[model samples]
Target: MRILVRVLKLLVFIMLINHLIACSWYAVGINDLEREDTWVKANDLKGKGTVYAYTTALHWSITQFTPASMEVVPMNELERSFTIVVIVSAMVIFSSFISTITNAMTQLRNLNSERNAELVKLRCFFSDHKVSASLVARISSCIHQSNKLTGSRVHSEGVSILELLPVSLKCDLAEEVFAPTLCAHPFILTWSEYYSRESKRLFLAARSSSLGAKHELFNTGQVAESMYFLSSGAMVYVRGDTRPARVSPGQWLAEPAFWIKWKHVGHASSTGKNCELVSLHCETAIRILSQDASTISGARRYAKTFAAYFDKQFDQLSDVWADVEVLQAMVSEAFIKHEKELLRHSVASRVVKDTKMPGLLRRMTSRFSGVSMASRLSSEEGMSQDEQINLILHERVRKYGVDGQKRREILGTRSMGSDSSDEVLAPVVSPVFRNPERRQSIGRGRFARNGLNVVPGIASAFRIMTR
Candidate 1:
């Protein structure tokens, strides 16, 4: 549509330029109409109609643009000079027009220029090699058929462009682009309802690929490296000589390869001109699901859900048990499903987050870190002895009331938490002392600075031992 609009614009520009040139020629004819040597007199346009005069002028103007010779000859010096001017102007004007068209074409081709460049390189690579022509043709055809653009496009370019994005954005973009395809799957439709984030990361880790018509994705007995999701196009699963089952879009192939070591038991191939499949490698699958301990259990739950989904699709368990092998398979699948659910629950119950002290409780407990109230208050640092005594008095009178028994209980709580042998003592008198004389009146000598800063718990224990 853009190219078409540009072409239309160029055409309109051409018409406008020609109309002006013709008008200039008509103006020249009118300027010297009476002169015998003038174009109007020499062409005998005065005897002819206005249409004839204009047509003659337009013809002369067009002759300068194209390779054709001019039909009307220049009559005099002025006419010859004007002819020279028109010819010179035509060169400049035509060059500009040619450049505009060339640029527009180049811009149009730029869209597929990357694809074209790769094809050219591929052709050059095969130029000297004596490879089969059929193989070359098929390779080229597949390149054109697939949409593997090698990250040339990104902003809304689907999940294939995720390699350029950050880990977080990759997960987010994957969630947005592959969610519909994932949720469309019968197994995932229910599975994702519980583990949506894990499902998205699983899609992120998957590598998407394209296949041409009848292209064998994997042959029977081929070592399986990836579990495939048929995002688009039909696939044929051929096991031994049985009828090839047509696998539709939004289906899984080699699902067991995702969780365990496995090999292809069937051949899978594209059915039409194109196929797009996203394969989650066993390594990548485990990495995505078991990023944390929580997700490990979630992965088991996913396997359990997937198993149950397929298990319900079969006929009654009794009917399938008619064959001994079928009976064994059913029992094994049931056991696997039960074990997965049981482990998922068990693992979830066992994940214990680190237990740290609560902030409020820690702060409250820290207030009783020292032996006596004053020494305990000293553990906080940056306070004078008088300030410590004032703080205790204020807190006791304001919050605990004037009861000495409650104050003793607070002291006991502090004593229980304190290790006074290792703590510094900062003794404070209960009654505020204004002078040295007042402090000395307690009768206890200067060295006797117990003041409840001693080991209260040890003393109590010793008293108990004596009893």
Candidate 2:
């Protein structure tokens, strides 16, 4: 489009120049003719009113000849010169115009041909099965042709990289370079190396079925063998007596018994209407983790730095698993040895202080002693006072409002003035020091005492030993 406009502009310029030259030539010729006519008229006027009888047949008489009475004679030579000059100038201008038009048309035709060839190549590539085989060759040929025509050697490898880079990254990188072609060359090499490494790693690419029916309580403790990555769905993580937490995409859920020596924690179920997940076997994941320590470390760093990026309830559990694995790799140890140091630092930082009773209370409540505590709280017999308090605290912290005053209210703490002004009195019962009786009917005893039936009675016996 721009080339066509420039051609039209050039033609207009040439015509203007030709018109000016023609006007100048005609003006000069007209001036010369006028001067000659004036000289002829003056000479004719001088010879007016004077005539001598020269012929025998004519009587002697005086003729009154004025300027107007003199007949004007045609100057054929001057007229011929003017005609020849105009014709020659016209021919030269016409030839130049024709040449200009022809050159512009040729350029347009060449551009159209190049565009058509590119379109044909693109269509062939899209339809052909040999695209992978021929792509490199086609790119190389195109680059060679372009460089030859432009008289500049372009880097073909760089062009190939730009073609392969994802559009978003390519656009961002393109703006950073002054000479895009040259800069793009090195970037292609870098990208190729990185891509080659990543292509070797295992990835999950599987379809998931719809979770239509409500599931009965699943004993995740018994089901072990696989690790699941939330590829395009959300899940709720229900652990012990605490409220379920949500887990979304990019989070990985591994059964503890399969990966580590710890007891199974909880089960995960779909949170979204239609959940699609990618399941990788436990052994496969462990093998990858063992092979690529750097990948594991990088994943951990990302999770820690962008913890808030995940809104799913299972995010913390996933992060803890990831962090422990990375730290284990970094320290080259089987067990985490820095727990005391971390606690000390937290106390020093005033994140947890002895003087602040609530902080101390929170520390006690959030502590996870072992699987025993978890099993005791989750069983049908219900939780002990300490277990219930721990579960409540876990729910509060998981919801990110553990420090709210409403928590203290739920724990039977009262306002200062209200406690003093209250006039309500309660009867204190004395403990009867009687000998313990052996229970015969275990079911009736359990129901009468704890309001629940005894089924193998594990929850009642699993009590926390206070220090």
Per-residue lDDT of candidate 2, residues 352-399 (tens digit) = 333544332333323443435465566637545444444543443343
Those runs of model 1 whose alpha carbons end farther than 4 Å from true positions after fitting are 1-166, 292-296, 301-467
Give the Cα lDDT of each candidate. Answer: 0.53, 0.37
Question: Against the true structure, candidate 1 has what lDDT?
Answer: 0.53
Q: Model 2 TM-score?
A: 0.23
Q: What is the TM-score of each candidate against the true structure?
A: 0.41, 0.23
Compared with the true structure, what per-residue lDDT tens digits does model 1 show for residues 421-452? 41221231221111112234222212111233
The reply for model 2, stretches above 4 Å from the true place, is: 1-201, 204-210, 216-218, 255-263, 291-467
Q: Per the 3 Å backbone cut-off, how many clashing residue pairs does candidate 1 have?
A: 0
